[model samples]
Target: MKRVVVGLSGGVDSSVAAYLLQEQGYEVIGLFMKNWHDDSVTISNECPWLEDSNDALLVAEKLGIPFQTVDLSEQYKERIVDYMFNEYEKGRTPNPDVLCNREIKFDVFMKIALSLGADYVATGHYCRKGILEKDGEEVYQLLAGVDGNKDQSYFLCQLSQEQLAKSLFPIGELTKPQVREIAARMELVTAEKKDSQGLCFIGKVRLPEFLQQQLQPKEGLIFEVDADSPVYHQEQPTFASQEEELAYLSKNIAYTPELGKVVGKHQGAHYFTIGQRKGLNVGGTKEPLFIIATDVTSNTIYTGQGNNHPGLFKKALFIQQPEVHWIREDLKLKAGEKMEVMARIRYRQPLQKATLFQFEDGMYVLFEEPQSAITEGQFVSWHIGEELVGSGVIS
Candidate 1:
């Protein structure tokens, strides 16, 4: 019998995933990942780690599968938590869920499952895995889940072919409603549990409060730039190469006091990100203000009056050579080559029409339509049809 280890995340999707694997005749084991134990930093009140673990145990028992809990708090901190703090300190937003799956679940947890003689590791991600044959070689394809509304292919965008080889997503073919119906029919403890929110392991947290734990509050100036400012009409530099053109195009506009009027003050410039609308607390505007730029060095925030602000959109973004990742390495683009692909900067955003330009320094993704808030430290996943081909950190 093929043995499979399912990561029972104390949620309905994972609960049903374990049951399906058992019905399919696999020797299944339910392992609950206890990734965070530090309550001092965790801000959520109800449904804490203890509750999640107990629910996982109940589901495993009902499914008649071996159940155990693994303490990955140490590794989680080092890989996800610490990495997040460092990114925020650098004024860049990081996606911890993506990193957690790549650095922890598939890497660390998979090792433990392999040590236990398991043939494959499984999760409840709403994405499908496909196999294709090319030149007598097996290539794995990460396809979007059939349920378009909940397709989570972006979170698994960084997964490599080898990782996908030994992985199974039993619930990929089902919709959120269908997964819940199955769990309800099975009377699982997590049958009607709401999806966990906020950080990957840590529960829902007030982001500003969470950051304040590590980042001290410092007063900074907030300057609101006009939509038709002279800065927006500045002359562009001629680029000799694609890399130079992309690098110049992808960077944020340089704003000075001459370009905008001082509007208000912020607690910290590092706490705010590009395109953020809320938490500004600044009023008396025709339209709501949105963050267009943040200068951590100057401790300044540059804002624009409305959603249609010129500063809110960009035509291109660059990913450095070191940050580029191709799940299908066999289909990677070489220098001076280009490909037309659909890409999205954030999870759940509809993929946009874009062209990928490869260069010696990095890859450039130029969207046919301007992309809003192309923030750094976020992964941009490109797709050919429904398959995710590559992803990279937006730089």
Candidate 2:
């Protein structure tokens, strides 16, 4: 029997994954990863790792599978935690969960499983894998889960062709309710456990507080820019090439101190992101104020009156060539090439119609409709039908 190492995350989904793999005649070994160790920085009583490890052990025991815990705290800190701090410090919004899957789970943990003679590493992610023959070569496809409401293909967007080759997602075909029913029938300990809302493996995080541990607080000005600012109505420049046009369209608008009235002050501009509406704590507006942009170098946050702020939306975003990754390498676009694909910048976002343009500088995704946030440091994935072909970090 082919041995499969299941990342039993002590959550209901992973619990059911292990059971299903066993029934499918695969030799399953349950491995729970201890990704975080610093409880001081972690929020108070927010699903501690110790508790999760115990729960994972219980699930493995009930399933009659050999189980062990792997302490990957050092790798987690260097790969995910440190990178998160570095990105936020630079005033960019980073997605740690996506990085976690790409760096730690698939890269580090996968290597360990392979060393143990396992043919594959499985997870409980709500996404599917598909294989097809293309030009006499086996092509792997990363597909959206059957359960539309719970599809997590976006989180695994950074995965490459080789990573998808040995990865298995066992619960992709079932909806959330069906997974719960299966766990309930199995009398699993995680059957009724609520899903983790915090960082991957690192429980509930108070982002501001967690960030404060690494980024020292410095007071900064919050200016509310008028919606009718001249920056919005500026004359378009002549584009010599598609790359130049995309480069201009994807760039963030710079806000000056004189742009608007000083609405409030923030601890730090780095703590905030584009399209943020909360934690501003500034009241007394006709409509709730939303953060339109932030300047970490100037230590200022530019805000707009409401959700309809022109600065809140962008039609295009650029991804550096080095950051771009293609799961379907066969479908990669060459220089000056473009393809129509459905793409989204973040998870749970309904796929929007977009066109991917590839140039020497990088790849750009221009959406048919304006997308909100479009924050830097976040990964954007493009799909054709159900198969995710490529993804890249938003520049």
The number of clashing residue pairs in each candidate reads 0, 0
lDDT of 2 by residue, 136-205 (tens): 9889999999999999999999898899999999999999999999999999999999998889999998
Residue 236's lDDT in candidate 2:
94
Candidate with best TM-score: 2
Candidate 1: give the clashing pairs.
none
> What number of backbone clashes does candidate 1 have, counting pairs of residues 3 or more apart or in separate chains?
0
TM-scores of the models, in the given order?
A: 0.97, 0.98
Q: Cα deviation of 84 in candidate 1 (Å)? A: 0.9
Q: Write the per-residue lDDT of candidate 1 for residues 254-356, one digit (tens) a residue.
A: 8776778888989998799999999998999999999998888889899998898999999999999999999999989999999999999999999999999
Worst 10 residues of 1 by lDDT: 38-47
Compared with the true structure, all predictions reach lDDT values of 0.91, 0.93
